[model samples]
Target: MVTPSTQEKARLGGRADVGAASVAGAEYSTIEHALSDALAAHGITGLAIRADGGIHRFDSADKPKGNRNGWYVCPTLEVAVYGFWHTGEQHTITTGGKADPAAAAETRLAYQRAREQREAERRAQQARTAEQARRWWAAAGAADPNHPYLTKKRLAPYGLRQRDTMLLVPLFHDGELVNLERIYPHGAKKALFGGRAKGVASLVGSLASADRVLVAEGWATAAALHEAMGVPVVVARNADNLEPVARRLRQRLPDDVTITIAADDDRFTEGNPGATKARLAALAIGAKVLMPTFCPGCARCTDFADVALCRKERVA
Candidate 1:
C-alpha cells in the first residue's frame, strides 16, 4: 500500500499513513468547476483555488477543519456568497447574504455625530459652571476688593498648593458671609470632614434669623438651594461631615429652629457612602430630611444648590 507524506496527507484530508489523493482528486474537480461558475455569476473577484478542493477570496491564518478544508469563501465587496464542495457535488451555502455597505457607513457616521454632540455639550457645561462660580464668589464678598479672602490685587487667593487642598464653600445669610465648610475633591488623600469658619459658633449660626434653613452637601448644592428657596443655607463639605455641623447647630440655635437636611435620593440606593452619612446626620439631630426629586439627566440631587436648580427646571 502506498503511504502519503505529511504534506500529501494534508492535501488529501487524511493521516500521514493514508493515501486518499485518488478519491479526493476524482470528487474535487467537478465541484471546483461548478463553484467557479457560481462565483463568476455573483460578480465576486480575487478568487483563488486551494489544493484541498477549497476556494477562498481572502487570506485566512486559521487552519481549515474537517470537510471545510477544501471550502472557503469571502466577499470582496460589501457582500459575497459562499459555496460548499462535497466530493463531486457543489452546494451554494449562502447567497444574497452580503452585508449592507450603507448600514456600515451609517454606523460610522452616527458615531462621529455622537462624538461631536458630546464635545459641544461638554464645552457648554464648562462655560456655564465657570459663570456660576464667578457669580458665587461675587455674592460671597470674595469678589470685593476689601474682603479678607481677596488678594490686594482684587483676586481670590489660590489655596494650598499640595495635591490635597481644601476648598471652602461658603454659605451666605442676608448677603453676609456667615458659614464656610471645607471640601476636597473626590478620592483625595485628605479626610471628608471639613473645617468650620473661624470665630463662628457653628455653621447654623449664620441662619439663626431665618425661619427655615436649608442644609446641603457641597458648595454647588448650597448655591442651588439659595437660588431655589431664597432662604439661608449651610453646606456640608461632604455627607459624613454633616454630623459635626448639625451638632454645632443644635447647640447654637434655639430649640424651635426648623432645620431641614436636604437629602439626595441617591442615599436610599444601596452602597452610597455620602447618602449614608446624610441619613446618620439627620437621625442624630432630629432634623427633617428633605430628599428632592433628581433631574432626569442630573447625576444626583445630593447638594441643596443642585436640588434647588434641578427642581425648578423640572417644574418649569
Candidate 2:
C-alpha cells in the first residue's frame, strides 16, 4: 500500500517536474467545458474561461473586483485553471493561501470559466466585424450608376487589387467619394486619404442653395447633415485641414455668406493637434463655429455620421 506521505511526495514531484508531461493534445474545448461545469457547480454565472496551453479566468457580465489579475489554480490531478486580465497576460497560483483548498479551487475555476468565454466572444465579434466589412465592400462595388455620387472611376480607385470586390473608399455626400480616405476590405491599416486634398471639398460644390454653409471634418457627418437639412456642406477631411479649406471657401463663396464650423467636442481636449489647427483656421477666416448639441461620446465632432451611428446607443 502507498503511504500518505509517499503519495503526497509523488504528487508534489509530478507538478514540480513540469517537462515530464507532454501537452500535445490539450484541446481548449475540453478545458473550457470543464471550467464552465465547475462554475455552474459553484453557482456562478456569466463567467468565462480560456485556454491555449493553459487556462485563464474572466468575467463576461461584469468587471471582477480587485486588480484584474489572471488567477489560476489546479483543480484536479490533470486539470489546471488560469485567468487573464485586460492586458492579455495570464496568472496562476500553485502554493498556499488564506482560503481552504476547496474554496480556492472553486474561485480559480470560476475565473477560468469567465476568461475562456471572453476569449471566445472576442473571436466571434472579430469574425462578425470582418463579415460586415466584406458585405459593405461588395455593396459599394455594385453602386447604382444613376446615383449622383456613384461613378466607375470613384469605385475603381477604392477597389482592392487582391479582392476586386472590396472598396475602401467611404461615401461622403450622396455617393461622392471624399479624399479617398481608405480602400476597404484591406482593413484599417490600408486607409488612404487624399494627399493634401481636404475631404470637405467633396461636398463643397454639392451644397444646397443656402447663404449659410456648415462644415465638418469627416464625410459621414457632412453627408448626415446634408441628408437631414437641405443645406450646403463642406468636409475639412480632418480638423487641421479645416482652416485652409475655410480660407479657400471664404474666397470663393460670397462675402456675406455665413460659414459655420462644426466643432467636435474632441477639439477642446488638451493634446489634440488637429483641434488646435482648426481653432487657428476659424480665428483667421472669421467663420462662425457651432458645436453639436450632443457630445458624440468621443473627442471630435468630425461629422454627423458618428452622431447618427451612436445616437441610438446613447439614448438607450
Candidate 3:
C-alpha cells in the first residue's frame, strides 16, 4: 500500500510539470498576436482572428461598409496570411524568431492555396451574375426613347432596354452576354456584382462590313461619335477599360479594318486620364487617337457628347 501511494504521487507531479510547460509554450508562442500586429501595420484592425485554416472575409478599412474586400487565412499555428482583394494587398505573419526552410515553404503553399481558392470563388460568382443578367435582359422591354437620361445626354436608345425607369446597357465578352450596366434616371450607373467587366463592351451600331471602327470611353461618347461619323462605335464603358476592349477588338476584326480610339479630353482632371488611357490603348494596337477638341474659350466640354451638346446649345 505504501509503495503504491508513493508511485501515484510521482506520476501526479510529472503530469503537473508537463501541464505547466504546455501553458508556458502557449503563452510564449501566440500566433494570433503576431497576425494582429501584421494587420495593424497595414491599418487593418478590429477583426476577429480565425485560426481554422479557412478563408474568412471582412470589410476593408478603406472601402465602404459591407464591402468585405479583406480576407485572411491561418493555415497553421505558426503561419497566417491576409489580403485586400480590391487593392491586391497581401501580408503574411509567422511566429518564432526566423522561419526555417520548411516553415517558409509551408507559408508559400498556403498563400498559393488561398489565391487559388479566391479565384475559383470569383469565377463561380461571375457565372451566377451572368445568368442573372441574361434573365433580366430577356424579360425587359425596349428602352423608352423619351427617358430622361437619353434626353439629357441627347442620345437615342440605340438597342438599349429598360426595366421601369432604369436603362440596361448590355455588356458582352467573347461574343457572349456577360454583364449589364444599369443606368438610373438620375444618371447614376452600376454594374452587376461579381459580373465580368474587363474586356467587356457595349456597341451602338453594327460592325459588320465596316471598314472603320471607333472605340470610346462611355456610351454617350460612343453614341455621339457613331451618330456624327456614321461608323460603328464600341463603348469601352470607362477609361481604364479602353485598352482591354481595344485589344480584343483588334484581335477579332480583320487587318484591313482601321481602329481609332475616340478619347475624352478631360482637361480639368489632372493627368487627363481619359486622353492618356486612350493614347495608350491606341499605341498598344497600332491604332489612331481622336480627342474631342473644345471650341475657343470653352472650358465645359470634356468628351465628344459634351462637345456636340454644347455646340448645339450655342447654335440654338
Candidate 4:
C-alpha cells in the first residue's frame, strides 16, 4: 500500500484541516466566510464579500430599508473592519490565522479614511441643499390667510411664505436661512432632503428689545404662545431638539432675559417624550418649564396650540 502524507490523507477524506475554529454555526473555512458570518451576527446579511482589500457598504438593519449606512473593509486577507455610520458603531475581526499587527494597523487606517470621507460628503450635500433652500424662500409668496392648513390650525401666517400649495416656514441656523419646513394642505411636514436641521429653529416674534423668550416644539405652538402672551417664541420643531434650541437661545439673549420652555404634553404616548425632553431642556438652561394645562375632562388636548384651537372651536 502506498503511504499517504498528512495533507494527502486529509484531502482524500474530503476535508481541509486549515485549523479554523467554528463559532455560532459559522463555517470558518476561509476569510471570506468568516467575514460574512461576522456581518450576519450584527443583523447585516446577504452581502457578497469582495475580499479584495476594498471598502464596501450595505443597508443597515437598524435604519429604514435601502439606507446604505453600514460599511466594511477587508484591508488584508486576515483582518477586516466594519461599522455603521448612523450609530457610529464599529467592529473588527480576523481569520483563524497568526496574529499580524501590520494587518491590524491597516484596518484601523481604513476605518479612519472611511469616516473622513463620510463627513466630507455630508458637508457637501448640506451646502447644496442650503443653496436650494435660499432660492425657494426668495421665490415664495406670502402665505394666504385662507389656506387649509392655517385655517385648520387656527393660526395666522405670521410671515410664513407659500410655494405652490405648500406653506414654507423658514429655518435658520446661526441667523442664516438654511432650510424650509414645508407644510402640506393635509398637515404633513418635511424639510428639504440633506438639509441640516439639528440646532436649527424658526422665530415667531421679534427678539429685539425683548426680555422674555419662550421656546416651544412646533411652529403653531410658538404662534399660539406668542399671540396669547405677546412674548417672542422660538420654534424648536420637535421634542428631540428642545435642548439644543433652548441652549442656543439662552446664549444669544442677555442674562436678564427669561426663557420658558413650553412643553407639548404628549399624554397619550408612552413616557410622554415631549414633556420629558422639555423639562430636561429647561433644567439645562435654568429656564422654567411650562406644560399645557388642559381644561377639565379634556383628553384630546396636548399642546398650547391644541388648547387654543379647542377654546376657539367652543366659542364658535
Best by lDDT: 4
lDDT of every predicted structure (CA atoms): 0.43, 0.47, 0.80, 0.81
Q: Better model by TM-score, 1 or 4?
A: 4
Q: Which pairs of residues clash in candidate 4, taking residues 3 or more apart in a chain or in different chains? A: none
Number of backbone clashes in candidate 3: 0
Structural RMSD, model 1: 22.7
How does model 4 score by TM-score?
A: 0.86
Candidate 2 segments exceeding 4 Å error: 1-179, 183-195, 198-200, 267-269, 295-303, 313-316
All-Cα superposition RMSD per candidate:
22.7, 16.3, 11.6, 8.9
Ten consecutive residues with minimal summed lDDT in candidate 3? 1-10
Model 1 Cα displacement at 185 (Å)? 13
Compose the digit string of candidate 2's lDDT tens values, residues 190-289. 3332122432354633544568897777554565566566576776667777886788778777877888776655645577554566567778788767
CA deviation > 4 Å runs, candidate 3: 1-28
Give Cα distance to truth, residue 58, candidate 4, Å: 1.8
* Error of model 2, residue 221, in angstroms: 1.8
Winner of 2 and 4 under TM-score: 4
lDDT, residue 133, model 4: 94
Q: Which scores greater on TM-score, model 3 or model 4?
A: 3
